[model samples]
Target: MARKPAAAYPFSSSPGSSSARPPQPNTNLNALRIPVTPERRPGAPSPSSATTTSAASSASRNPFLTPSPGTASASPSPAQAGRSTATNRPYGTASAANSSTHLMPPSAASSTASLVSSSGSSLRPQPTSGNTPRAALSAPPLNTSSKSATTAPPSISDKFSLSPDPSLWGGNLSLSDREADDYLHNPDPKRDRKNDRGGTMFTARGIVNLGCLFIMAAGLIALFAGYPIISFFTTTHQSTQGGYNLGGINQTGQVPEITGALGLIDVQTPAASKSHTGWMDQSTYDLVFSDEFNVEGRSFYPGDDPYWEAVNLHYWETNNLEWYDPSAITTTGGNLKIWLNKTENHDLNYMGGMMSTWNKFCFTGGYIEVSVSLPGDPTVWGLWPAIWTMGNLGRAGYGASLDGMWPYTYESCDVGTLANQTQNGGPPDALTTGDPDWNGALSFLPGQRLSACTCAGEDHPGPQDSSGNFVGRAAPEIDILEAQVYQSTRTGAVSQSVQMAPFNAYWQYTNTSNADFQIYNAEITEANGYLGGVYQQAASSVSITNQNCYSGHQSGETGCFAVYGFEYEPGDSGYITWINNGQPAWTVYAPALGPDANTGIAQRPIPTEPMYILANLGISENFGAIDYAELVFPVYLLIDYVRVYQKQGSTNIGCDPADHPTAQYIQNHIDAYSNWNLTTFDDFAAVSGSTWPKNKLIDTC
Candidate 1:
C-alpha cells in the first residue's frame, strides 16, 4: 500500500496545511537514539571538545531555531563538521550536536529533506514559502544487496513520520553494514533496549503499572479481612435458660447423682438437653410431673401418694409366678423400693411389687423418664424387671372389658364384612355372642366374653350406648426398658419395643381358654399370623453393659442403675423414640406402627390417647425350663425417680379428649381409610350423629 505524505497527516507542522502542530520529540525516543561519535582526523579538533562547546553555547538558545544538520557556514566550524558527519550516516546514528534536529517544524524543508536523504536515498526539497504546494515524496527503492537481500528497507514515512512503530527510535531498527559491524564489535551501553523506557507516571505504560499495583493491594486486604466477618454471623450463642431443676433432688438427698444420661436427665435442664437428643429443641417442653421419692418410709399405696398406686392384684395375663403385693412397695433412704421375696400368694411362689399411675395422671405426648436399679445379680435367672406405659382407657388389673385398649393403637375395619353387616341390618350374632373366633373367654375373667373386633368404649367398665360405641379407644403400649434372660450366656441385655395389634391378634391370646391357648398361639405364629406377620411392628434391644449406664452391670445385678425413657409425638405424622441410658436406642414412625394385616397398608397409628406410667418387677414364666429352687429371692428393684415433661403450650392431661377432638378424629379416619384398597367406605362425617360406619372403628373424644 502507498504511504500517505507527512503533510497529509492532521498533526503535520507544514505551513498552509490546515493541520495541528507536529508533536514534540518523545523523551523515550531521545533515550533510545545512539549518539554517534565522529572518527578523529590528525590535524582537526576532537569531536568531543567541539560538541561540548557548541552544546554549552546552544543551551540558552531556542531549540526550535537550531540550524539544520547540513546547513552550516561555507567554512564550517568543527561542531558543524561533526554534526554533518553524524547526520550523513544511517538514520538514528546522530551525534548530540544534532539532537535538536527533531524539534524543527515541517516548514524547515532543509532539515526534513536532509533527514530522508541521509538514509542513502535522495529526496526533492520542499518549498519554504507558505503558499507553495509541496509535492508528495515517493518511497526509495529497497536495497537489493546481500546484506538486505531478504528484508526490504523501511520506507521514509515509517522512519521520519510520527508513526506508532517502535523503530521510529533506534530500538529494534535495521542497521546499515557499517553500523551493524560497529554494534557487533564495540557495543554502546546507551543503545540497550532495556533502557529505552523513559516516561513520567502520566504516560500509558506508567498508568498500567500503577493499576496492577492497586489490584494486588486490594486482593491482600480481602484475604486478611474475610474470616472474622463470616464468623460474626455463624458462631453459636449460649442458651440463657438454666438447667432443669429435678425437684431440687441434687441439693439435699441421699440419691446418687445422675450421670452419662441424655435428654432432660443428663443435662438436668431443657435448654441443654436438646444438645444431646438432636431431635428437637427440648427447651420448648415444660416440667409437668415429677416424683423424687425423697421422703423416708413413705407408702406408695393409693391413698398415700396422689401420683402413684401400688398394684395389689395378681397379674395373670403373662401367667407370671409373682403376685404384686402393695406391702412389698415402700420408700426409704430417699428411694422407692420394690422388693422381690419368696412367698406363697394367689397360688404363686413369689411376691413382687408393681406401681402404676393409671387413673391418677396421664399425658398425650411428652418426654417420660425413669432411673432405677434392677434387682438380683447378673447370674440370676428368671428375673424380669420392666418400665413401661399403657393407654389410660384401660385399667391395669381388669383384662376383660378394659383390656380392649391393650394393643389396638389405631382403628381398623373389615370393609367387606362391615359392608355385609350394614346390608344385613346390624352386627352379627357371632360378634355379640360367644363365637370363639370373634369374642373369646378371658382366663382372668372366666365368664366374661371380650370381642377383639370391638374395642373398649370411652365409658369406664363397658362400651358407650351411643352411636360412637364401635369407635374404640387407642391404647398402644410402649415398652421403654425390659430386661430378661433369654439366654443363660447373655443376661445383661435390655429390650425396647413399641407393640400394637391393629389386626386384634392380641385379643385372641388374652381371650383364649387354657385348653386351646397353645393351638391358637400356633396359628398366630405362622407367616400370615401374629409372629413376624404383616401386622408385626418394629423392636430394638441393647445390652446395659454396652451402654454408658451407672455401675455398668446387668439389670438384675446389685448397684446397677440405668436411665430408661422415651419421647412421644402425638399425631398421624408423629414418632416414638426410646432412650436407653441417655442415648436413643430405637425410633419408630407412626406410619410404620399399625399396618393392616390383610392388605399391608400403613394405618399411621401413633398413639394420640393419653397414657399413664407403669413400673413392675415380675418373674416371667416364659423363660425356658429352669429350676426355680436355684434362684435366690429377697432381691430389690430400687427406683431413683420418675419425671414427665410436656410441650410448653400443650393442654393434654390424663384421660382428656381435648388434644384429639372428635372433629379431628373423624378427619383422621377419613384420611387413613378413604379409598383404601380401591374400596371406599361410608362417610365418617356422620360419626357425631347416629350414622357411624359399621366397619370402621376410631377414637372418641
Candidate 2:
C-alpha cells in the first residue's frame, strides 16, 4: 500500500480572507502554531460573516476567484453538497472546513501598508481568554483612494507583529530594540493571536534542538581528546619503570592515588624506604662486573669479555624454535645487543643469542643492576627477552655437591635434620627412604657432608622455624627482569615476573616446580615445606588494566622502558629487593639458611654459595604460552649496561678486592677466555683448566 502524505495546515486564521490577521501576542502562541486545531470558544461568531465578505469581494474584483462570504447562508442549504451549515457543523472548530466559499479576492492579501488607509473597517484577532471571535478586533476603515498603498506580499514582520523586546521572555532571546519599536507602532491583532499560541511551541522546539547540539559537541570532544590524554599520562616517559596515572595502575599492577606531579617521574612511597640510606645504590661499592661493550672487531662480540662465555647447548625446551647462536651477539652503541633473527640453520628455523658469566665470575651476594630495552612490543607474540643470573655451584670444579653436573639435581629432604661434616660433590642425597641409585648417596669430604637435604618433606624449602613458619632464604637464579612480551596472553596484560630458584636440598634447583617465583601478572602462591614448591604465606594478586600495549598495529612506540634491578645483601639477613627504576617496588627476606639449625637465635647459617651473573635474549613458552607465527622478525634486545657493584670494604670471601677471581683471571689469562668467547661449543667439554686459581673452602664456588 502507498503511504499517504500528512495534511498541510493553513497559517492564516481564516481561509475566507486573502489577508491574514497578524498573530496576537500570548503566553501560548508557540503551542497554537502546531498542527492541532484550537477548540472554538462557546460564544464565538459563526463563519458566515467571514465567508460572505470573501465571496462578495472575489466576485467584484475577479470572477474567476471563489465566491464572497456575504452570499453564504447562515441556514442549512441542500444545494451545498459537501458543506455543512453553522447549526450542523461536523467539526467543533469554525475554520476546519475546506470549501470554495471560504476564499477571498487576491487583492485583500496585500501587505500591511496597503490596508492601513482602507475605507472599510478591517478585522483583527482578540485575546485568548476573550470568548469573542479570534478576528473580531475592529480597525479604522481603509482609504481606498490612498496613493501610498501598494500591493506587495506580506512577510515575516507582518505575521510576527508583537513586542520584540526579548527580555520579556527571561532576557535570553535575540530580539532587537528597533524591532520592538515597530511592533508598538503597528498594533496587529492577527499577529498577536498567532504569537500567543506559537510562543510555547517554538520554545519547546528550541530546547530540543539545543539538547541535540550539546550531545553532538560532547561526542566530538571525546573523539579528539581521548587517546592523547590517555597516552600522555600512561606513557613510559612518566616513569622509567611503570607509569601510574591517576586512578590507574603501574607495571607492578598497583592502583596508585592521584598525588604529586602527574605525568612526571616522581614516585610517592613510604617515608622509611624513601629515606633509608642503606640501599645498595646509596652505599659505596667497588665495580666487580663492568662490560661497557664499547669494543667491536674480529676479536670480540657482545658477550666477549674475559669473564663471559657463550652458551651453545641447543634444545627444544619451552616450545622455543630458536637455537643458541653465537653469531647473533654483537656490540654496538656502547652496549650489548642480543639479536633474535629468523634464520634457518640445519633443521632449526629460528636463532637467538645467550651468554653468561657462569664460571668465570661468581660472588656470594651484592647488587646486580641492568638497564636493558626489550626485544619487541608486548603485543608481539613469541618475543621473550630476559636479563638474569643463575647459581655458579652447577659449574665445573665448584666446591658444592651439585658442581660439575650437566643437569643440576636436588635431593629429597623428607626428614629435616641438622648435621655438619658436609662435602660438596655430586647430585642427590640418600637421606630419605625408597630412593634409587647412588644419585641420592652422600659424598663425604673426609670430615663433613657439605650438601645434604635439610627441610623435611619439603620440595621447595626455605628458611623456617621449628613449627615450619617461613623465616628467610637466599634466592638463586635472580631474574633482574624477565620481559616475556607476550606473556600476558592468558592474564590479558603485559607483565613482569621475577623468578628465583626455590630452596631445595641442592640449593639452586633448576626445576620449574621447585622454583620460588614472584609475578606481577596474577596472584602469589605460597609453596609450603613439601618438596620445594610449598610455602607458608602468599601475597594475593589482583587484576590490573594493562595500558602498555600500542594503540595501533605499528605505532612505532613500545609504550614502556623500565630500569629493573635485583639486590642481595646477606649481611641484612638475606634481604632481597626488586627495584623499579629508583624506587623499591617490593622487598623479601629470603635467607639461604635452613631450619635444621634448630635455633631461633642468630646462630642459624646463611648461604655463602657464589652466584654468577647472566643476561640473555631468547624465546620461551614456559611462563606463558606463545604463538610463533604472530611474531615480527629481526627483533632485538638492547642493553644499555650490565653493572655489578659490591660493598667497598666488606669481604664475603677472604680474597683481596684487587685479586678477586674475575680481576685475577683478566690480569693473567685474559687471552684464553676472551679469544673463544663467540665460539659455539660442539662438545661437552668443561671450560676449565688447572692453571685457574683456587680459593679457600668457604669461597671455592
Candidate 3:
C-alpha cells in the first residue's frame, strides 16, 4: 500500500524565500498551536497588531526565536514541513513555547487537532519540568490509519528544538531530562566513598598486587636460604664409602646405612685428594717410588736392597768427622734407623749411616717426600742430618769416574777458554780436540768442564787428575732438608738449598739486580756492577720451620716426625718448591735464574737431568769441634718412609743406559786428555764433544 506524506507544519516559511524551512512532517501540533484566549501582559499590543507584526519585530521581542535574513515565502520547503517553530529553544520549554504560540496563525488553531490526530502521541514533546501544564502538553488522540501506525515518529530535534541555558544547566549540553532522572535515582556508592582512607589499598586489584609482591619475596628468601639448609642435612663426605646418619637415631647407636643422595654428599672422588699448597692437583700425582721399610732386621748394605744402597765412605767434601758405615744403617721394627755413635774406625771418632738411590733410581721432575724423625739428643754436637739429591751423572761417594759433574745445574760450555783453541796447541783432531758444538753452534760451553777447556779463569776448580789438570764437568745439587746443629745453637734448625756453578752468561744478560734474582741466605759478591752480584759460591738457601710440627732432636721419639717434601719441574715455566708438612716453605721459578747471554738461548736453563736421592747422618767438623763428653751417644735418625710421585703417564726416572751414549764413548774422551802435552794452560780451548749425548748422560745405571 502506498503511504501518504506527512502534513506540513503551520509556521513553516514559504518556498523560494529567505525564511523558508524544511517541512516538519512529524512535529507535535500541541507545542505550536495557538490558545483560544491567549493571555497578554499589561500594556501589551493587541492580537491584531501581534498577528500583523513582522517576524523580525517578533524575533526582536523574543530572544528564543530569530527571523530569516530576507522576505518570507508563501509555501514551506520540503525540509521545513514538520519542523517546530521553536528554532532557538527546546521544544518542551514552557516559557519559550508559551511566548511563541502567539506567532502561530489563527487558522493553525483549528488545524492543530487534525495535525495532532494524524501525527499521533509518539510525535508529542515531553514536559521537562513538573511545573509545566499537563493540559497544554497532552498528546492528541491515537491515529488508527495504517500509514500513521507504521510510520516512525519525527526525531526529538524536529518535534522539540530544546537547548537549555548553559548558565542554569552547569554546561551539561548532552544530559537530557531522562538522563538526569536516571543519575538521581541510581547513585555510584564507590564514587561516593572515593576519598575515604585505605580506599584504593583495600581494593581487589590492590590485594592481587600485594599477593604478587609477597610471592616474589618468598621466592627470594627461598633462593637465599636453600643452600645452607640443604648443606646442613647433607653429609659432606669427600668419599662415599662410609655409612652416614640421616636425621634418624638407631637403637644400636650406630649411624644409619643408606645409599645415594640420602646418605652422603660426596663433593669429590676418592682419588681427588686436596692439594694443601694449592699449587697443583694432588690427585694427578701417582706414586712412582716408595720405601716403607716394613721388613724388620733388613740390612742396608751394598747388596741388601734393589732400590737403595748404603754409602761406606767418609764424606770428605764437608770435612765431616763421621765415617758412613753400612752397619750404622738398619731396618728395625719397620723403620730405617741411622744410628750416630762414637767410633774409632776409618780414622774418625764418630760414625753414622748414609743411604742413596744413586745408580739404581733417578727422576727428572717429581714430588719427593720423606717422613723422618731426626736425631734429637740435645747434647749431641756437630750433628748434621740431610736429605738431598744430585744429578745422576755424579756419584755420592766421590767416585773417580763421575765426580766432575757436581754443582752444574744445566749442561753448558766452558766459557773461560778461547772458542777456537785446539787441544795441546795442535790441529783439531778426534783425540786432541773434542766436540765444541753448543746450542747448534760451535761455541764455548760456559759450565761443562774437561771438554777441551782450561780451568785458569774459572771461579771454581774443576775435578782434577793425578797431574792436577781439569778433568770433569760440574753436576747440580738440591738440598731437601738439612737439619744441622751449628755451635750447639741451631739444634732443630733445618735449611733447603740449590747449589750450582755460576753460569756466567746467565748472570751477564739477566737483570740480576731485580728482586727475583736476589739471593737469600747466601753470600754475594758485588764486584763489577753485578747487582745481587754473582753468588760467591753458587748456593742459595731458605730456612724451613713449623711451630706446630716437632723439630726437636729427641731420639726414638715419634713426636719428632715431620713430612719434608720437594717438587721439581723442568722447563721455562718450571719451578722447584719446598714444602714442610704440606705447606709451601719456599719456591724458585726457572725464569728467574736467567738465560744464556751469549746466544740468548736456553733462557730458563733449569736442571733437566734426572737426579738421584740421598739421605745421610754425619758429624761435621765444619760447624765446631764435637764435645764428646757432653754429646749423647747412640742417638738415632728414624726414617718412616720415602715417597716419589709423578703425573700420570709421566716418569722422572732417567736411569736407562740406552737413552745415553755408551760408557765406552765417555771413557774414550777422558782417556784422550790423559797425556797432557801442552806446556801452558793458554794452549787449551773450551770445546765440547760433538758426539756427547745431548739428552740423558751415561750414569751408573
Candidate 4:
C-alpha cells in the first residue's frame, strides 16, 4: 500500500531562498516591504510600476525603499537617520572586510514572472560601481543529486502519494535531518512559529497557491469516502421515477436509484414510537404471523410442529445436486438453520432443507419480513438461498379446495382421502377474456413451480396428470430476494435481484424468452403491467439488507444478516412495495390487463388470490456451474425470524368462512393453520415483550 507523503515544509522566504524578496539594508526598508511594490521595467506599460513609484513619491516621510525626487528633498529626523543604518548590502552584496550598506533601488527586484522573460533577459538590474554584479543575486540551477538535494522535482513517491514532500519544492531551502524531522512530525502551528525567527514570510501569491492545492486534496478525499452512497442513488439517463430502462446493464453493474412515487417515503409515526431490534414500528399494523424460530433443539417436521412443514423435493428441481430433506432443518438458539450438506440422498450427492406454510399459513395482502443471513461470499460458486412466497388459490380451500393443488398426501390433513379432494378448478375465467388455462392438466391454483416433477405418470388426471405430476398455472411468484454473488469474485462487485412473475399473458411471452425477462435496475411503474417489475443491484461493499451486510462480513468470511420485506395493498391496480432494512425501497402495481398502452400486449391483472409463505435453501445450477467436491460442507442459511403483518380489520380471506369450514380443520383452525396472531402493532409488541415499533401508516403509496 502507498503511504501518505510527509507534510510539505512551510514556505518561508528568507535571504537564502531565491524566491525571497531582496534583503533590507536596514530596519527602515523592513517597514517599506508592506506595500506590494514590484520593480518597474523601463519603458514597460506595467500597472505595478506606476503604483510603486507613486506610493514612494507620496510616502517619502515614511521609510521608502525606492529613491524618488520627493525622498531626496526630505531629510529624515536624527533618530530616523541613525536607525536607517544597515548590516549588509541588499542581496548580500557587501564584502567581508568592508560591510558597506548600499541599498539597491527597488526597481532591481522585478516581478518573478517578468524576471523569466521568453527572451533571455537578466532577472536583476546591473550593479553600480563598487557593488557586486547582478549575477550574484540570481539562483543557480537546482542540483537534486547533491547531498543537500537543493531544488529537485518531486520524487515518484511524492508525486503519487497523498501529500507532497516538502524537501522537493524549489523555493524552500533543503532542510537538515533535525529540521526535516521536526517539520514533518510536529506540524502544530505553535512549534512552527517558535522556530520561525523572522516572523511569517509567505507572500500573497504563495498563500493563494497553497490554498488551491488544499482544496483539490479535500475534494479527492470526499469522493473516496462517499462513492458508495453516491453510486447507489445514480441511475442511467433513460431511467426515471416509476420507469425502468433496461436498455443495457452498466459496465459496473450498478443498481439505479429509485425515484418518483416508487422511491422511499418516510412514514411518520407517533412521537413515542418504539425502535426495538433496530426495527422502527408503526401503530396501525397488526402482527398476524411470525416464526421467531424460538423452538430449540428440534426440527419442524410433521405432527406437533407449530409453524412450518418440511417438504421433500426429491431431487426433481433446478438440476440441483441436493435433495430437500426434513432432517437438514433444525431450530437452535432462536434461529432456523437450513443446512446444505453433501451426502448421498435419493441418488443425489448433496442434500438441503426446505419448508413452507402452504396449508398451515397463508395470507392475501400485507407485509412479510424475514431476517436471514446466508453462507458463502458473492463468488461461492453455486449457492441459492431464497426467502419467497407463492400465491395460493388451491390450498386456501376457497371452494371445494383440499389444501390446494397436488401436495404430498398427509394423513393428518382434514381434506379426507387425497384422491377425493377437489380437482383443478382452472384459472379464474373473469381474470381475462378467454385466458388459455395455461396449465392444461396442471392445477390452475398457484404454488411453487419446480423445474421438474415425477409423482404421477404421463397420462394422469386433473390435479396430477402424467405430465410429470403437476405444474403451477396460478397466481404470481414473488421472489422477495434472490442472489447470484457466485458471478462476482470475493473482492469484486456482488449482484442480486428482486423478481415477481405474474402468471399472465405477458408472462407467457416473457417466459418463452426468459433470458431477457429481467428488469435490471429501476422502479417499475403500473404501466409495465403485473407481469414485469424493476430490478436493483448493489456493490458487495454497500449494505443492501438481506442479500449482504457491508459491515458484518469482511475478508472472505460471509456471516451477514439483514431484514427484507414487502407490502401489498389490493386496490388501484394492486400496489406492491418492496422493502429493505425496514425502508420501503420500491413499488410496482398491476397494469391494465389485456393490450398495454405502450407495448400493445395483452397482460393479466395482478392476481387477487392469497399466497402462502415459503423459505427454501435450494442449490441450483442455474446460478452457475459448481463442483460437488469444491462445495463447502455444512453451509447453512440462517433465518433469525419470519414475520407477517397486516392492517387491522382487513378481510381475512385466508380464513373467511367462504374459504373452508373451520370446525372440521385444525384446532383453533384460523390461528393454528395460519400461524397468525391478530393484534395491533403495539399489542403485539407487548405480547412479544419487544420494544420494537410497528408501522403506523396504511401504505407507502
Residue-level error in angstroms, candidate 4, position 294: 2.2
Of 3 and 4, the candidate ranking higher by TM-score: 3
TM-score of each: 0.45, 0.38, 0.44, 0.39
Q: For residues 1-701, could you state the per-residue lDDT of candidate 3 as single tens digits?
A: 12121123233223334344445554544333221212233453333443434333434444533344463422223322222232332333333223333334333332344324344544433212322222223222233444422223344553544322232221223334366368657777876567554356877998999999999999888778976787777956433111111222221243334333112212221233322222444536666556777667777676455556787777775678888889998887667788878888778888999988654566777788888776755434557888999765556655333333455554333332222212333222211222223322222322344332443433222344466443333346787887644443543446666665443333332334333343332221111221112221233444434322332344334454678878877755676777655555656667656554443223334565557789888887664466667667777777777777777666545342333212233233332222222211222222332222221121121
User: Residue 205 CA error for candidate 3 (Å)?
Assistant: 99
lDDT tens per residue, model 2, 235-258 = 754221111111333212444343
- Strongest candidate by lDDT: 3
Whichever of 3 and 4 has more lDDT, that candidate is: 3
What's model 1's TM-score? 0.45
lDDT of 1 by residue, 321-434 (tens): 899998998887767788888999878889999988654566678888778766665444577778888875555555432323355554433321221122233233212322
Alpha-carbon RMSD, each predicted model: 25.3, 27.0, 27.4, 30.9
Q: What is the C-alpha lDDT of each candidate?
A: 0.48, 0.39, 0.49, 0.40
Worst 10 residues of 1 by lDDT: 441-450
TM-score of 2: 0.38
Each candidate's number of clashing pairs is 4, 79, 34, 16
- State in Å the error of residue 560, model 1: 4.3
Distance from true location, Cα of 81 in model 3, Å? 99
